[model samples]
Target: MNITTIGFDADDTLWHNERFYVLTQERFADLLADYTDRASLDARLQAAERRNIGHYGYGIKGFVLSMIETAVDVTDARVPAAVIRRILEIGQEMLRHPIELLPDAHKTVAAMAASRHRLVLITKGDLLDQERKLAESGLWEYFDAVEIVSEKSAAVYRRIFNRHGDGPERAMMVGNSMKSDVLPAIEAGAWAVHVPFELVWALESAPAPTGHERYRVLDGLGGLKALVDWIG
Candidate 1:
């Protein structure tokens, strides 16, 4: 492993993110408890999320819209106006929630930056929301470049590698989602380190990589510094 540049995924990888979504979903379920059961509401909301990903993309805004859509569908379009108002409130609350860094995220990132590795943040979501989180996290200064993309794919990784990095062989992506961060970086010819988060969005879940030369998995960010040191 001769990695020179390292890219990080911003959401659950670097901070507590999906937990807020889960919390809001629970609130959403409670708000519409009369319309359906928890299991049924969860399924319908997931369905709505999948359907709206193309139109709204991923973020609190999209999640809020999905909740509203699910509410309308489950209630046969009779969802109370107050419920809709509450749903909007949920979205606003999520947007306003404080950015909580995951355990060792700050230390590990600082170590990587101190080691002179070129660091880039590659995350996908609403631009304003993502920017706000980055600003609040106070880790923005560590990154040499920040990319808020519509989606994470091989092409996207390739472009980032070409522009900010020496190329795939010299680049590594560290993140939580195998589907978004690890796999695509590998597909783009870069090394990838998977740092699994306890709660992952169903949309971002995928099978772990096995026996891949450029792929490695660590229990958490605690191992990130040593891994990058070894790679360097």
Candidate 2:
């Protein structure tokens, strides 16, 4: 089947998302500086994030909670209230940070939209935060659909593509994460395109589907529209 629907992942894929977390993590390291060194602190925080994701899901809130958990752990529950306050403030700063669209993000989505393909924003994060980002992004109108999911799996991809387009066979999932966006979408029988961002979070990291025919990688989103045309 010809690809008629395209799934775009938000966060680092469309705009500057991971960079915020990178900055906030730096702050987290600072907040816990007296408790542990940077290397150890980073490892602990990553461990915390991995554990908390199942409970808190994903987004600024969960990230903040993970930071708090890490802080408490490294300090053996002796973490000062002031340090916790600063952590909360850090999260608020992130939530209020302005969305900066990645290079070619707008043009590529517009081109794909104009070409008459159904463009769906498929992302997993806090619902209100994701909605807020989309509203401020100014690319909202270009999307034929928007899915704010708690997670992305083969079943979710199949259901989304089938509902929003023809089916997984006629859809393409485009994003930066190999784990969340690529592997599962391909497993669901859709084309999966990996467009790398500068910074990939540890949790989102996965081995590329190296030899899969359905998998494709672009240097960036600039080449995406042409590739979609070629695929069609």
Candidate 3:
């Protein structure tokens, strides 16, 4: 069947998202190096994920705030005012850094758009941050629609599918996160492609059915051309 609509997950799927977070996080850890080790700092950040998922929802910004909370809670050593200023600076830096899309993302997305496929960007994150990134990346124009959701659940996918009024079989989802991009789309009866990044966070679950024929894990975004061509 010819593909009619394509749904894409932003962040690590098309761009270098997690790496920026990782960089800023390491810097944050450096500021607290005297009070906390790298391993311990990572644990504290992980703990914050567990704690804040219920309260703050998801995304890098939320994770950054969690790091701040972790710093405030774990360090018995009197954190100087300078250290707090450093943490806030790191957060501001994260906000200002422009989004860097993965290799071939622009070409592939443009290629699909040229082929008359309705390209929709479905991302979950802080609404304002996600919007800023999309606006800055110059990718917003390529999509027919853009959704910034709180979480990637079955209901979210279902809602997008319902809005399209097209059958799920004709829709395709591409992304790096297995939990957020692949499994949920598959459960919704849509085809999914996985272009994994170098690092997958512990908070995001891994893809379980690695060998499923309907699911694909590409070496990189360049391979997307062949996949989309075949689907066409």
Candidate 4:
């Protein structure tokens, strides 16, 4: 476990994120309740989100667009313009929301930085929005480097580790998403730690690594110090 560098995912990994999205989705469901049931509306929104990922990628803007699309689809293009405006307002509110760091997120990252770990933030989303969140989170100074990618894949992890640190074998990734954070890092030959969030995006959800030698799941960020110590 000779890890020389560590990568972190943004969004739910370091700060409160999914909860806001869930709240917005609940509002969206209510707005469309006249057209369909909550479950059906949710399903349709998810389908729209999935369909729009390639076009919009992942972020609040994409989400708003998907919600509007879902609203129109469900209502047979009869959704009011005011309702569409409300959906846009929802996305704007999310963009303006305060950054709330997860429990021990700052302390853990600070500790790791103090311990001389080369910390890198590897996140995927709209660059401007991710940049805004990073700046607002106040955890920016701790990271030696920051990567705002359109997506996370094994090749991307491998390239990042190779360029920023020693190599994949000596690198680790920590995040909540098994799909974007852990699996890709593991596939790139790096160690990964899963810090599960209470609410995860459906697109980012995946089964946990069961018996992988280089994978570990922590209940929360507070356990990161112990894991790093054990690795050392």
Please provide the root mean square deviation of candidate 2 (C-alpha atoms, Å): 0.7
Superposition error at 5 for model 2 (Å):
0.3
Look at candidate 2 and give me any clashing residue pairs.
none
- Give the range where candidate 4 is weakest over 10 consecutive residues by summed lDDT: 25-34
* Pairs with steric clashes in candidate 3: none
Query: Which is superior by TM-score, 1 or 3?
Result: 1
Name the weakest run of 10 consecutive residues (lDDT summed) in model 1.
Answer: 223-232
- Native RMSD of candidate 1 (Å): 0.9
Which sections of candidate 3 miss by over 4 Å?
none
Per-model lDDT: 0.92, 0.94, 0.81, 0.93
Model 2 scores worst on lDDT over the 10 consecutive residues at 26-35
Tens-digit lDDT track of model 1 for 67-158: 99999999999999999999999899899999999999999899999988899999999999999999999999999999999999999999
Against the true structure, whose lDDT is highest? 2
User: What would the per-residue lDDT of candidate 2 be over residues 15-119, giving only the tens digit for each residue?
Assistant: 999988988888888878777999999999999989989999999999999999989999999999999999999999989988999999999999999999999
Q: On residues 1-232, what C-alpha lDDT tens digit does candidate 4 reach at each position?
A: 5788999999999998999999998998888878899989989989999999999998999999999999999999999999999999989999999999999999999999999989999998889999999999999999999999989999999999999999989999999999999999999999999998888788898988789999999999988988988988
Which should have the higher lDDT, number 1 or number 2?
2
Model 4 pairs whose backbones collide: none
Q: What lDDT tens digits, residue by residue, belong to model 3 across residues 111-205?
A: 88888888889998788888998888878888988988888876777788667637567788899888889998888877889888888888777
